[model samples]
Target: MSQPTIRALILDDYAHNAFREAHIERPQPQAHEVLVRVVASGVNPIDYKIRSGNAPYAMPELPAILGTDMAGVIEAVGADIKHLAVGDEVYGMVGGVRGLPGSLAEYLAVDADLVARKPKNLGFREAAAIPLVFLTAWEGLVDRAHVQAGQKVLVHGGAGGVGHMAVQIARALGAEVFATVSPGKRSIVEGYGATAIDYRDEPVAQYVNQHTGGKGFDVIYDTVGGQSLDDSFAAIRLYGHVASCAAFGTHNLATGSLRSATLSGIFVLLPMLTGVGRKHHAEILGYATRLIEEGKVKPLMHPQRFSLGEARQAHDAVEQGTGIGKVVIDIA
Candidate 1:
């Protein structure tokens, strides 16, 4: 029998207009893999960077599919797979880089350990938006920082893709969460059980003192990196821990050193890029699923929807910063 064909969003070349719908070969699961019939895919900044050939990592070769996060129902399970079976709903940060076909397709063959059962409370699109951002936040705040109840946690860029997840994860772990966002987004941040600080008007030190009563946040999660990360070093309490996912600029660590604080940078792609720690990614997704099912976490979705063919427009919304929440592509 011949294999079925699948519709995928393929990037034919390193051009801004390269993403388009294409008929591609549907993949079959390997021994430790699962074949998923993708219902939705999430768009992130990395997608556009890879599309433009500007990302640090090597592209998957010509005519590559361009997505990392997906939510779908399992269609087939490999011989070695046990935890999941056919028809199980799952989501994960599978493929999209390093020669692997991405989730922007109607089907995906993904390593079983990289995926987790989706929350029964979430639909395909909402679950699709959770994996990447939730994994990033979990690895940094829960795994690395070990955020505890009563610990004061500060998340920069609180309304962002990863930031919103960080805020909720910290709160779920019983931390006193504080997040920084624009004045207009204060209510959104506050709604997540975080004390919102208006970044445009409130200096880091001011909010740090105001919210923490001059003790400073015990854990500072920098989702905005760059100058925000630098500011985090100063805002954190003495001996506090700082974790950044987007540390891109040259900054003096002298402030952190003087305060006796520790800094850790999170790169969620390390597992996908190096093939190490893949199981932990799956575990984190499971944690996120539980949080969602318990109503402790919810995905912040953009009002608009994009089809696989309109992926470029989705990318544009993320780049332009007008997207209110996670941008999703309907892949069914």
Candidate 2:
């Protein structure tokens, strides 16, 4: 009997910025996995970073199928998977890091613990856009900071991928949300019920004083690292919490320490790399599904569309920061 092969985009070299069309044998589900027929694949900045061999921490081996987020239909279920069945629509940041295969293919065998049922309100493309960015935001805001009602929350880089999700999640948690953005992109954050602060026009101290009465925010989510993380320490209230996904590089914690603020670093890829917290990823996505179906959260998608054959263009869109919102490639 001949093995059934599925169409896919394979990356043979990390030196190039393109994918090659190829057909590979379809994967079958393991006892804890599910076979998914991929419908859409979300493109993140990390995708390009890994492709160019820049993200060494989570980079896959060469000649890999590289994609992290996916929306799809379950075609087969493993014996241990009870909550999900064949034919269920699901979405998650399943793979594309280290030893796992990614979603840039017609079919994927993903661990059952890494996915949740797709939000009833969103189509495949929209659902695909939600996983990586949403997971990153939720891990920082809900898991680490424990955001609560009436708290003041600030999201740095609110117009970017993880930043936008942080803004919406904070708003949905009943926090008085504020987002820092460029002047022209103010509306992007404002439309999500966040007070937009023009970071370029106003210095960190000025905005902290103006919006927070100089007491500083109760919680700060810093999506942009480097100087932004430093600014977060200066802008956090005494005893407040600050969570950052991009907390790389040397930083002085003197400001935060002076205020007695709590700082947490979020590395969302750790679960995929170490396999220590895969179930938590599914739980977070389950919460996202409920929030999305209730109309409290939704994904912002780019205007331009790309087919599976145009995967290169999708990576380019994310890498160049040309997409107004999340860029996705239709796989099915």
Candidate 3:
């Protein structure tokens, strides 16, 4: 008998209008994999970037399924998977990059180490909105910056995907969190339990002085890279740490070096691209699940919803930044 088939959105080319829907054969789980019926998938900047051909480094072969975040119920578990079982709800940054099949499909056979039990408090869409951004923030703040209680943490681009998560993660880690957002987005940062700074209203040093008595933040997280990274270097206290998930452009290290500070770059896709370090991604998601259950962290979701076939619309929403929060695609 033939394997079961499922519907999916496929990108046949690097064009904005390339998403096409069709049915494909379902995948079988490997020894270290789990087969999941994806209920929802998260739309992220990278998804749009790849679709527009702007992210050549992340380019996948044509006719590829393109999505990075997903939450679903496990349909089956591989032989080596001792913890997960059929009917378990799980989520993760399973694929959608390199040659790996992404989550835009109805079903996925993902590495067991990369899949984690979804937070009981969140539905599939909310859980889908998390993994990538949550992992990016946690890796930068918890793993790299070593955030601690009472430390002054400043997150740049606080209203953005990773920035929002960073702000909440820092606050949950017992830090005095502050986020730099536009005046229009002040409420968003404030809603996440962070002190809001209108980035447009003051210079970095001015806010640094007002917020920290000119001592600078003990930790700076720049989710908006480029110039924001430069500002982060200036805003960090002496010997403090700075981390960024979007540190893609050329950077000057003089200010940070002069202050004896450390800067760490977070590329959350490393695990999906390479076979190594996948377990850490799963571990971070587990921690995020706890934060979710504790009500300390929640994925900021946009009000609009899309179906699996509406991949282009979801990508457009993220690219245009027209959505209130994370744009999600319902698959199941």
Best by lDDT: 2
Candidate lDDT values, in order: 0.89, 0.94, 0.90
Instruction: Report the C-alpha displacement of residue 87, candidate 2, in angstroms.
Output: 0.5
Displacement of residue 160 (Cα, Å) in model 3 is 1.4
Identify the runs in model 1 with alpha carbons over 4 angstroms from their true place.
Answer: none
Clashing pairs in 3: none
lDDT of 2 by residue, 1-332 (tens): 98899998888888774789999999999999999999999999888898888999998887889999999999999989899999999999999888989999999999998999999899999999999999999999999999999999999999999999999999999999999998988999999999999988899989999999999999999999999999999999999999999998899999999999999999998998999999999999999999999998878889899999999889989888866899999999
* Displacement of the residue 162 alpha carbon in candidate 1, Å: 0.5
User: Ranking by lDDT, best first?
Assistant: 2, 3, 1
The residue-by-residue lDDT of candidate 3 on 1-332, one tens digit each, is 99879998888888653788888999999999999999999988998888778887777888788889999999999999899999999999988888778999999999998889999999999999999999999999999989999999999989888999999999898999999998889999999889998877799889989999999899999999899899998999999999988889998899999999999988888888878899989899899999999999988899998987678888888988876799999998
Runs with alpha carbons beyond 4 Å of true place in candidate 2: none
Task: Give the top-scoring candidate (TM-score).
Answer: 2
* Model 1 / residue 73 / CA error / Å: 0.8
Estimate the TM-score for candidate 1: 0.97
lDDT of 1 by residue, 1-332 (tens): 88779888778888654777777778989999999999999988888888888885746787788798999999999999999999999999998887677898999999998999999999999999998899989888988888999999999999999999999999999998989898888888899989888888888778877888887789999999888998998898889999999986788999999999989888888888888999999998988889898999998999999988888888899889886999999988
Sliding window of 10 residues with minimal summed lDDT for model 2: 10-19
At residue 243, give the lDDT of candidate 2: 99
